[model samples]
Target: MKTLLRTLLIPALALITLGAIYFLSAFLGMIIPVGPEKEEYPKEVEIFVHTNGLHADFVLPTTHEVHDWKDVLEGKHFGEFETPYLSIGWGEKNFYLNTPTMADLTAPTLVKALFLPSTSAMHVDYMYGKPREGDHASSIWISEQMYLELVDYILGTFELEDGKAILIDHDGYYDYDQFYRAKGKYHAFWTCNNWTNRGLKKIGLRNSLWTPMDWGVFYYLEK
Candidate 1:
């Protein structure tokens, strides 16, 4: 019994230590600016970053002067209602499909997500109006050129076929939203928040050094 206890103790302590290190790193990364200071552009376009306590989504106006999302995402998927904005997010396929709410989450789903190179999907939520302040959302003003470049970066993250998004047939929990196949594998290190961070970095926004949680993305924005 003592021998068995000794064997179990080492692995248990190792896991606890690792957990502490991960959380510490995430906290410090949020407070520290990893990249250069955010740049300001002469011309500004409003974009939103939203969080649902756990995940982050980028919200952009549907029709920008440079690119109209309707050119790609049609009104049909959004119940034929021409929304003014779209909220987009990316996550593990299994988590996205199986766990629309916290109640739907399970240990197996989390285990597979953290341990395996899982498939990914993108979530699209159409909105009739712009996101308001105090909506747990942060708004950034970027130049039209930067916004256009960010648009290209975003669309590129979708796994497209013949210049079209690969639609995933699963129904979203909300009526105004849908899912599509996405590029990259979702794992413990490279998470949905990390994807958002990278997207912000691509557009020369202030972002965390390394973050796996939603708060990390918002921390820099709030500051």
Candidate 2:
């Protein structure tokens, strides 16, 4: 009786404690400001930030005056998806590869994702057309320099070998997408949504001061 009670009580208390810390940190982090005091550069590139209500992705044009991703995100690497825009997202390796949907998530996977700083992967989805502004998507325009800065930050995240992204041999959630090994570890402090926010911050765009949630990143976007 005592052993059983201890086991249950300890995990329950730990969960409660972690939950409190997460929310409290998020609230404070979002409030604290980062980035330029004002956006002065002319908006030259239009990009999309997309969320499935949970994870966020940085959606950029496949080919643009600023940069061309044709050779990098080649169609031959994945199924044909030579669309106008490509959506890139980062997440824990096990979670991204194993859990295709929320329903597929398991207790061990969730626990490992939140607490463990494990391997990460980049999920690239090629879009057929420009995403219309809707509940799940939002568009923002930034300067050419800012866009280039974003390019550097994002492209740098990939675990490139021989000056190229190492393709992972796995099917995407959709036929038009593929996965690549990425730099960095996914854990409590830096999540997929947080990666979007960080990129926005790097480009002097509007973003949450800090966020682990997708909604927070979109919520702080320019109205």
Candidate 3:
């Protein structure tokens, strides 16, 4: 019995230590400003970052000066309702398809996400109404150039086939939404929230140094 206890103790302590270090580093990364200083834009464009407890999405206008989102997303996927904003999110394909809600989440899905190189998908949600003030959303005002750069960064995430997004044939939880095959592989380190953080960094926006969770991404945005 003593031998068995000793065998279990070391691995248990090691896991606890690793967990502590990961959370500590994530907290530090959330607070630290690692990118370029926030700059003022003459011509402001309203973009938003929204969080639903665990996941994060980057919301952009449907029609910008440089890019017509409809040109890529199309009206067919969005249904009859005309939406003003498009909310985009990325995640592991198996987890996304299998676990639409918290109730559907399984241990196997989570274990696969953490241990394996999983296929990725992008969730596109069309919003008719704007994000209200004091919502679970952070609004950022950026220049036209910055907006263009941000759009380009988002477009690059899509795995294009013949200059078009490869739409995944799956019904999303919401009405005005769909999923598409994304470029990157989803893993323990490179999560959905991390993707949002990288997108903000790409456009030279104020963002966390390294965020693997939704709250971590929202912390600096709220500040």
Candidate 4:
């Protein structure tokens, strides 16, 4: 009995210690800024960064002067709806489809997601209008050039074949929301929030050096 108990305690303690170190590293990475974002450009286009306390999502107007997302994604998948904005979020495929609520997340599934690099998917949600400034949401004004850069980056993330993104047909929470196959692997270092962070960085937005949580992306924007 003593031997078995000792064996269990060692690994349990190790896991706890590792978890603490990871969280500490993430906290530090989030606080450190890459550099000041380009403020010289006129803030003409409005883009939004949204979080649900756990995940970060990018919200943009469905049609911009330079690009139209409806041209890329099949409008029919989102059903017939008159929406001015669309929300996009990328994350692990299994986790995204299986774990709608945190309560549904299982230990084995989480371990696989964090340790093993796996398939990724993008969630596209049609929005009726722009979100107001409030908890879990914030807006950023950027130039047309920067917005185009961001748009290109987003389009590249899609797994295109025959010049179109493949949709993952599945039963989900809303008729207005759907998932599509994406071009990246999901892992601990490259989290969903990191995808949003990298997109901001690519568009010359002030962002964290590295972040694993949604709050990191919001830290600079909130301030």
Candidate 5:
């Protein structure tokens, strides 16, 4: 018994020692500044709808950085809920988060809050090609109601001339012609895929509990 115990103790101690070294190294790595960290972009919690005819101006939230979406969601106290939508704002990025209409709207005209410049948007690196399986840029997980409403608005408001609607891409970088064509080519990527559109279809709602992946980006439609 003594011999066996002695033999086991040596390897156990080595493992413990190695674990300590690894923990220390990992802890140090977090603190040691590597490259210039990306500063958290400002976000707005509330939106104000000016009386003017112009669209509402979204407020800016505090300029704070976080390690991941988990941190952002945890702080909000709605930890039990999962976000339904995922979107990224390019430089001056624009994409519909929820459907907008003259009815079921609070503002006199139309107010939609666009949560933009999210950290998720910043994390993406892109090129003009079909997004891969794990392409974060391609997948947007939106709740069913918001998805349908957006689709309705898209189908109703915009006339899809030449088999395409005007989509906001990479900050509307291309002219109207290019933007329309891009949407025609990449409609499924933005609208359908994964458990997103399917999940939305399963649970039919007019305005599903669709929240942004970075829930921080939105613009008020009527406000």
Candidate 6:
């Protein structure tokens, strides 16, 4: 009986030792280099551009005033207008950001509209003097020339469709029924909100992360 027990224990101990050796071998394989491989690093894509080519780090705020697109067009101080703004809250309803045609916008802060005047330095075919594609949610205007340049720049700088940028030309002012239709594209829509959101995220901001900031209110005329 003692001999039978010794034989069983001996076999079990040998099996366990072999299993431990196999596990260590696999672990060591992960740490030791056995073949040629390339090291990778995080990639960053630039979204905003200053005339002088200085990039303002796109940082998001914890809370901000919601924009009234019509009021902004009517010359209201829609927060900071010189640099674009971005937000991440999902909207429950559609909001107005631009009109189909050009109209005289009159508001107390009407002077702010000078930055995006239609008949001055830049022809305002759409609000901000940009071309409008006939969608309320896509309330953006850019020089047909600038738009093309931006498209090329975005495509060349990053792997857009899936990598860095998505198209923002669908449904309401927030996520809505038509939102997905604008997916897998770039730079058709132009809102300060959209621009800043894309800018911050492109610079490595995840949806739920809180980052440090310095807040200031500055007013400048648009050229």
RMSD (Cα, Å) of candidate 4?
A: 1.4
The 10-residue segment of model 2 with minimum total lDDT is 73-82
TM-score of each: 0.92, 0.92, 0.92, 0.95, 0.21, 0.18
**Candidate with more favorable, higher TM-score: 5 or 6:** 5
User: Which is the winner by TM-score between candidate 1 and candidate 6?
Assistant: 1
Name the weakest run of 10 consecutive residues (lDDT summed) in model 1: 72-81
Q: Write one digit per residue (lDDT tens) for candidate 1, span 1-223.
A: 9999999999999989988988898888778776667554665689999988888989999887888877776436545667889999999999998898999999999989987989999988988887776647998888888898888988988987777777788788788888888989999889999899888988788788888999899877887
Sliding window of 10 residues with minimal summed lDDT for model 6: 212-221
Model 4 stretches astray by more than 4 angstroms: 77-79
Candidate 2 accuracy as lDDT: 0.85
* Higher-scoring candidate on lDDT, 4 or 6: 4
Summarize candidate 2's per-residue lDDT along 6-50 as a digit string, tens digits: 999999999899899989999888867776556577878999999
Q: Provide the overall lDDT of each model, using Cα atoms, as 2-decimal numbers.
A: 0.85, 0.85, 0.84, 0.88, 0.26, 0.26
- Candidate 1 regions exceeding 4 Å error are 36-38
**What's every prediction's RMSD, in angstroms?**
1.8, 2.0, 1.7, 1.4, 22.8, 22.5
| Candidate 3 similarity to native, TM-score | 0.92
lDDT by residue (tens digit), candidate 3, 49-152: 98877789998898877778877874365557678888899999998888889899999999898779899999888888667646589888888888889888
Candidate that beats the other on lDDT, 2 or 4, i.e. the better one: 4
**Which model, 2 or 4, shows the larger TM-score?**
4
Tens digits of per-residue lDDT, candidate 5, 71-137, equal: 2211221233333221222111123222122343444112112222221111111122223322122
Tens-place lDDT digits, model 6, residues 1-72 = 999999999999997897676446534432332212322333222222221011112212112232222221
Superior candidate under TM-score, 2 versus 3: 3
Q: Which pairs in model 1 have colliding backbones?
A: none
Worst 10 residues of 4 by lDDT: 74-83
